[model samples]
Target chain A: MLLSHPTIGRLVLSAAVTCGLAVPSYAEDILIGVATAQTGGLAPYDQPSLAGFRMAIDELNAKGGLGGKYTAKLAIKDTRTDTAATITAVQELVDAGASIILTPCDADATIAAGQITVAKRIPTLTFCGTAPVLATAVGDNLFGTYPGDNLQATVIADHAYAKGFRKAYLLVSPDSSYTAQLPEYFAEVFKKKGGTILGTGSFTMGQPDFSAIVTAIKALPEQPDLIMTAAYEPDFPAFIQQLRAAGVTTTVYGADAIGTGTVQGLGKLVDGTVYSAAGYPTPGGALEAFNKRFETTTGHAAESAYEANGYEIGLILDAAVKAAGSTDPVKLRDAIAGLDKLPIVTGTITYAGTNGMPVRAVSLIEYKDGKPVFIATQTPAAADVPAPAH
Target chain B: MLLQQVINAISLGGIYALLALGLAIVFSITGLINFAHGELMTLSGYALLAALMMGMPLLPAAVTAVAAGALAAVAMERVAFRPMRGASVTSLLLTSFAVSNLLKVVFQNAISARGKPIAMPDWMAGVVPIGSFTIGVGPLMSIAVSALALLGLELFLRRTVMGAAMRAAAQDFNTLRLVGISANRVIAVAFLLSGVLAGIASLLWIAQRASVDPMMGFVPVLKAFIATVIGGLGSLSGAVAGGMLLGVMEVALQALLPPSLAPYRDALVLSGIIVVLLVRPNGLIPAVDTARS
Candidate 1:
């Protein structure tokens, strides 16, 4: 009786065909390579993205992949978050005969892999590489699925300025390129907007002690309206907790790295802090279906905004492949670069007329009583974004 | 403002002292700068996380975590360090480094390379105000715990026979071995004491940081090494003094340095330390070749 049902029978037939038990006479298989940091400091960023990537691919394959002609098969290699290892992973994926490659989230780690994909002329998309250099310096073949970090900085600066925060104190983390660049971008926008930077401090990553920084804040001659920090996890929560505990309740503004499990772990201490990130999921927005599938696949709901960005890679690639009408590397690369206003899971993504920075809206999420609530979505104005020297 | 900054310095310094003392204890007895000691702190953090996840109360979880550190140190000494007895300092240092990396890798693969969040107790999150200044419960706890631990360690070293044997071993290892004292017991006891210090340090650190990661131990261990060098290697009192000095100097530099020069604070502080070491090569309190009183 179950097999007799029309929908169930079609599903069974699709499953059998997908498993290759029932051979299709004219079916084609396309191999996509994924070179990512499956295990390393970058793993946290890439893991969720990998999940999203798989979910998108699964959905496509289920509905008959690529005009019902090409079924995508993945060749995955772990980068281990090391440059040498990343190159090796990319080489392995390329050798596996993949037409396209997906790189890791961290820009520095993604560069070497990106170079390989560029040399091979494969269309390489990064799930969350925020550095603007990925667009300008890496290569033309390398495209980023996430918004550039400069856009995030502009959005935060504009948000703070709009909220009447005239004086700002900044904190810099000198561990990674992303953290180091955040303050520079923020200071640039804030200064340009007639806001005064009251003071600045710095800390090395993994240095748990923030008391010195706290003491410095308390000793400031004049209190700033907002405290801006560009710090990553483990250190991010520690900094926020110590600042609040020391009774310096100035509104804290930070980069996308602020929306992490570590910040959530701070309970009520993280309240009132604001940050900008890539994607914001609504109750019935584009992400609802993917989020539900992601929950079933990962057994947990998506935490980071990059999940949507990760899911976008598949949609972007599908669109590119369709536009190219061929799986040839050069043609696909050109097609992806020429993508204009193509709707993806996050929003409409277009590589046309812009540097590798994808024109997308960033969610300004603010913490209220220890939970992040969607405040507003703002698109970074092109005039507001400063071009990177590189 | 001055009063609050001073409190901040002392609280921060106390933590450094606890870490430095652990390094000092093992160094004085065995002359082995145990780089793996930081992994013991990491282990303690994991233990605390595990206990909390199991729904244990804060005090009990903290105790369990500290005990885990102590046990891990003893186990490490018994398994790894004991085999390399009478080895060159270079070999021992290499072995310690190996142990540190090995532990880090294991933790990374087993748990996560990313940090795991550990919730703080509400009591530890409170801020107490006195006059014009306010102190966080986390910092207050760190200061109180370090002081009590140091006092306890001092009493134990001064009052116990085992402690006396450790001091004698530090002064002259061969002489202590020849004088009918079991060198093995003395070394093992030194490691046990070191583990206890690291365990206590982990509790206060986790309370403040509120998260755990495999790499968490690396920076603190570096600070401990720096503090030990500055305090006078092998001198317990010197170690404590050095830790407090480093903590205070760091805070003071951050507070006083102008905004433009602020980012150079660490560089300036290290330069200052280098100048001091140039003057006092043996450190601020050079270790005297004598047993503890």
Candidate 2:
């Protein structure tokens, strides 16, 4: 009855205009703002996800756009992994009639860019950030589109327990929150699964020499069943090399931090190493097909599971857009929060009743003959998952 | 346990000493710290990787790395620094910083931000038994190769006419020119020798990490600079001693510090250096009065 009144309907359109909501039209452009790092230390992590995100966008365009009507256009801005630059890029995107926003794969940069989108009341989410704090850091509008570090650590611990690895030693790199906190959560989850932490050894990331840490681990009264460290690139190579040189060949476990092509040339040195990832290709599953499309589109193989995460971002946007029946940021944000068991290329993800981080299955992967071989995808039991670190 | 940690200290120190000696050689002759010295190492690393890709054997690839470093240094001196031959110290230092950044950006754009994985020699990845003690073969090679490089540089500096010319230039460049020794040759030889040392350091660095990136030389060079200062700037032998001391102090703290305080190891080493400087302002082995005045 209210919509039947022409004057009242005109007032509603004015109100929407005043609130900075773009009126959705059947053939109008739906701006998906992408403010991510294209170059810098974060580039290695951000680029592959960007490639997958582009693939998803291309697939949507082929299907006559989102919800088979409005054309989705990606308005990309490179943040260059700088905080001030991230803020500026986010502001520029919001001013350019953006409907939804994507942040970088890092927590600091995500929070930096998300702060502006939050202030603007736009729905924004990190494409591949694993930090749990992002869910609560940048107001209620920002959401996490990646698996949390706590969840990954729990999956690792649960899998390690299944492999009969009971005694663990944590290699903590206090230099990064990702490196530092993942091991703590792994310790908690491992303890819950009837494991004892033999000891904790510390090292700074990018430390060229890991001999001191290796010596400390070798000196442990009991050799750990597993050594868990979230250290990546340059650091992981040196650590694995030194650990081998010390003749202490305890199984090493890690998270997605080392999931890049870092282990490709490592050959037998890292053959048995295990780590958790957001997704991995099953023999004939959706992820395999998605990866094939990614290679054909990007002219290179998907670098990491982050590519899978990126594609899921598109599925989420589509689901939210369809549910909300409009591109308004406020409406889209509520629609996304209400998504339930939405199936993706990786696995089913549910955001309903969550603070914003999704509940998704994690893939346990291992390197065999210098190639990543998927082992299993499992969602750790709620009791085994550790509480998110502050 | 102590012996193993000691071996670790020596190996790590060898790299610092090698780099510090290289930095000292350039500074002693040119009166410029040459921050781009780090880029020399990175250049050598990429050259080594390229050589490996060309199907060269490991031995020849190593030679290529060393040669590439030397040639790059010579070219760098000819192109960038030669123009400002008599510039003030600040001007030369700033130029070197700019060159360093320029090279890093080029590497990032032309190559990649990710590290290129390098599969090292089997011996480097294995352990060697010294009687009842086992040590990494890579670390052992670092110590031996660096010692050999240091000895060769010392012999070259002491026994050759070019070496005396370099030392004379360090003491006072104008005086050397007054004596009719060519200043350009002395400076050129200084950069050449510095590059050779950097090549050796780069090999050791890559052996440890098994990968190379655009800015891989940054931290090693930073540590080497500190060692040069601690050893007294412009003193080659002092730089070596300072590097070994810094390496030893680092290992000691890493071994002794509690887990909660381990992150402070770098801060502690720096503070200790300050104390050493406070006690003896000229460094452990200060250079002979760099200026006759």
Candidate 3:
């Protein structure tokens, strides 16, 4: 009404234009709530993904924030790898006015955190909730950026079957949902392919000795052609050492959990062991370039492909935010769902119609000379991929 | 095959015995369980890695690792445990527990929660074969080192003046004090001996794990603590016997249990121990009590 005055309106319009041109700062800020396992058992897995987020956020800011109008700030809270603590952390983040929440990598903790966020209608993204059941369990508010475990299982199963290996002995660790559900998925796919499971072995996480299991495997009348597992870290290395030292030369296969730099530490002990990977650090490629950038920024070579998995999350989210043109959780969730063939550090990811799980290629990598060697990137046919276990 | 399994059991049991004996030494002298004994082992493993990284030769690195444990134990006693001298058994146990968790947190936050790979010697991972039977070198070294450490402890306790003072203190601290032996010195020496034993046990553990993490000491310490309880607390000989028996039980279960029962092997081993404890409450080789008068 005041601007309707002929002289005053012309003067006010000129002043508004002048002020708008005077500052290059953002018009809005987006607070990203990060609840992750920063200091406990899951830290090794979560920290790398956090590093990728940091790198991606830095790049995003460098490019004029979000579409030259908004800047993102991470409000991080440590979950400490406890489910109850995770619940509290997510609530605290939401209460502090976060528009989006990032959860810990493991499914149990992610679900614990997501329940609160989903109730608040906030968008939640898991660092690496590979379990397919997470999509249904947590509803549409949650998104898992990491490749689903079922996809990796199918790829590994198909590859093993192609090698004329019909018999498999599975070593299962009931420690985490990732470790527990992955072997079951493999068995599901492998059995469907007409292969027989020789036997199964179980262990709690971080079992200091695998000699007992090794001995039992040795006593089996017919040795398995290949052994499959999703065990990680110190446990996996210990198992491999004892298994090989006992003269069990069967080929070993694994899920994405085994595709970390930790196996490189085993040197020749892990040679010929093939595992499904979320991404590979290809030479002179985009992933390698990002790795170099990560090294320059953090002063350490990227520890694992998890770093790449995390980088992909950032790129995908940034694209989602741009496509949405707003930071509202609903709009952002919708935008995320509409993403298609988006290139990230790892590879192209498609979330459209994937039901919170991204459809992406799974890399198969082998250890040679104590280093990861990329074999092939596999994308199982939609018909071949087993449905997510309810 | 049976012989090969027996060898495996002995080496695995040897580690338990070595660690249990370390705990026994501290408990005998100070009446404290030294729950941090496991942390001492963890410190030694990290020290060994750090030394090797610094271009030290294998022998010197190992010596440094052992020495690191001794120094940490002595310092821990002087700085943390000494101020509470004559405190109740429960109080000292809690203090040690606090100390153990504190060190593990430091290892988790200040260092890393993830496991760091320990570059092992080739011979440690290698296996020796004899007439269609193959045995791992790690087990053999564990057995040999454990035997040497035990024999050395025996000679020290029976032969040296300081060792005699320690033994006397174990029997009766007041009588040793009446004869002019300083309680602090004797307790410090006991800690030193225990730390050295823990250091050796760390090597055996690292050989099997091939990696070091903040929680690396958890299982070993838990097993050794169980062995101590089964062997009769504060009795060195009992601790060794209990550890050996526990190892043998574990091997037997592993060899006998069906594949379906493999995961329950540890559970069965524990149940068998419970039965043994029921039969012999004071452990297999209970310590003798000396006459006060």
Candidate 4:
């Protein structure tokens, strides 16, 4: 009101005109609240994924803000891999008026943040919440960017069955929700496909000795057709080394955790190791282009599967916002739920009837010469798997 | 299979034994747990990695790693712990923790909080078969190195004046100081020996795991601490025995537990430890003359 006085209003108008002539002003930024672990134990996974998300955001903004009206700005909050920190970070972002919230890769770590977004009625997308029930369990506002764990497990089971491996031995790290769930889903799908599970073993995280597991395998009446396990590095490589050292030549299969620089460091030991993870880009595709850009930007080629997941989440959010035709959270959430065949850098994500699970292609890759060799892309049929046990 | 598993047990036991001995040495002299002892191992591993990356030969790199550990231990003594020499036990214990966390944060910032891969020589990671059994060379080396280091430590303690001084200090530091022995030198030597053991242990550890992280020292240190407690604090031989027993128990349980019950093997081991403690409140080998006024 003070500025609206006749003489003052004229002076302010002249000053605004002068400033506007010197520098163009951008419209208000559409805020994206990204809650991820940038430090602590999870940083190895979260940092790379966050870089991918940043790349995607940069790419989107380069094309002139979302709908040419609002620039998509990130309000990144580091959860430090702590539950309390995740809650506080998400709350701060929500209070700061984030239109949608993005969460970390692990379902367990993101649960608190998901609760906040749900309570606030803000649409939330997790970059790599592979657990089957993360979406339904979290809330109606939660959407998973990656395919459910059941899908990847089913993908591995189907591929193994196709390879004529009907008898399998399973090993799991009962250390985290991610590792523990792999064997369950794999057993479900493999048995449904008429494969028999010969034996199973479990261990804690950072339990370096796999000698007992190897001994157990050797005790079997006959060698199993396949050896399957859910593991991450540095345990993964050590386990493989010990298994090979024990002269157990049976073929091995693992989850996406095997697809990391850690396991790849195993050199020839990694050869012929088959694993299922989220797909990367096809040649000359958007993901391929993004992968190149990512290498240049981060000074390292995308090293983990979650990196792709991180990039895919941003593209997914953009598509949902465009489809909703408004920034309203309810309409955006509805549109996100209804998204079908949305082309992403990783693959097409369809969210129509998946109970908030994204239906996307899971990659079947074999290790050859210390790098993943693409075998084939697979979309597991819903009939070939059992429903998640909530 | 039984013989092979025994080999595994010995291999695992050797690491715990060495780590426990290191912690025990420092604890015996200072009555401080020296939780930061693990960071000495971590620093040595990182130092070795850096030296190797800089094209240093394997032998010299190993030496440099050990030296790095010793130096870090001495540095910690001078910079963090020395000033608190006459402080209360509670403060000293808390200082060790603060030092441990501070070192971890420094490592996390300077290097990485996550595991960084270290290339092992083919010989280091190779396996050798003796008749019907195969033993990992890395594990074999751990056993041999621990045995040799233990022998050396034993000889030093019994035969050398400095080692005798350490023993004297462990029993009664104030008395040793009253006799005109340098308390500062005795403490520094104790730290030096502990760091050297940690450095050697670090090499063996990285060989098996093939990677090192800030938290890499955590599990080993935790196991070592448990071993020290089980063996009897302030008793070096007890620490070694405790570590070996724990290692054997863990490996044997892993091997013998039925497939259906294998997942609970660690819990079972912990239960066994609890039972043992219940039976013997002072641990398996109570330190001599620990009934201090």
**Native contacts kept, each candidate:** 0.66, 0.60, 0.40, 0.38
Tell me each candidate's TM-score.
Answer: 0.87, 0.91, 0.89, 0.90
Per-residue lDDT of A83 in model 4: 80
lDDT of 4 by residue, A1-390 (tens): 344474465355334333332112234467777788777667777777888887777778888666545578666666777888888777777776678888877787667787888876688877776777876677878887776778888888888998999999988766677777877788888887799999887877777677777767876887899888877766776677777666677888998767777677677766788987777566886667777888987687887667777878777888877887767778888988898998887768898876787888888888898777889888877787557755
Instruction: Give the Cα error of residue A55 in candidate 3, in Å.
Output: 1.7
- What candidate 3 gets wrong by more than 4 Å, as runs, is A1-27, A64-68, A323-326, B259-261, B265-293
DockQ winner: 2
DockQ of 1: 0.44
Worst 10 residues of 1 chain A by lDDT: A18-27
TM-score of 2: 0.91
RMSD vs true structure, all candidates:
6.5, 7.4, 8.6, 7.1
Q: Write the per-residue lDDT of candidate 1 for residues B1-293, one digit (tens) a residue.
A: 77777777888899999999999999898878999999999999999999999999888998999999999999999999999998988898899999998998899878877688787766776789888777777788788889999999998888999888888888888998898999889988888888888999988787778788887788789889999889889888989988998888888887777766766878888988898799988888877762321
Local distance difference test, each candidate: 0.81, 0.84, 0.81, 0.80
What is the DockQ score of candidate 3, to 2 decimals? Answer: 0.37
Q: DockQ of candidates 1 onward, in order?
A: 0.44, 0.52, 0.37, 0.42
lDDT of 3 by residue, B1-293 (tens): 67778887898889899999998888888888888998999899899989988999888998999999999999999988999899988899899999988998899877787777776766666778888777777777889999999999999999999988988888888999999999999999989998999899998888777777776777777888889878887888988987888777777776777656766877888888789779987767665551210
User: What's the TM for model 1?
Assistant: 0.87
Clashing pairs in 3: none
lDDT tens per residue, model 4, B1-293? 78778878988888899999999998888888888988999999999989998999988999999999999999999999999998877898899999988888788767875677776776765668889766667667778988998999999999999999998888888898999999889989899989999999998887777777776777888889989888888889989988998899999998877767877888998888888789876678877747520
**Which is the leading candidate under TM-score?**
2
User: What interface RMSD does each of the candidate structures achieve?
Assistant: 2.1, 1.4, 2.1, 2.1
Candidate 2, position A131, lDDT = 80
Q: Arrange candidates by DockQ, highest first: which order? A: 2, 1, 4, 3
**Candidate 3 per-residue C-alpha lDDT over A269-374 given as tens digits, one digit per residue, 9 for 90 to 100:** 7878889878777788878888898999878888887787777777877887888888787888888989999987777899898878889999888888888899
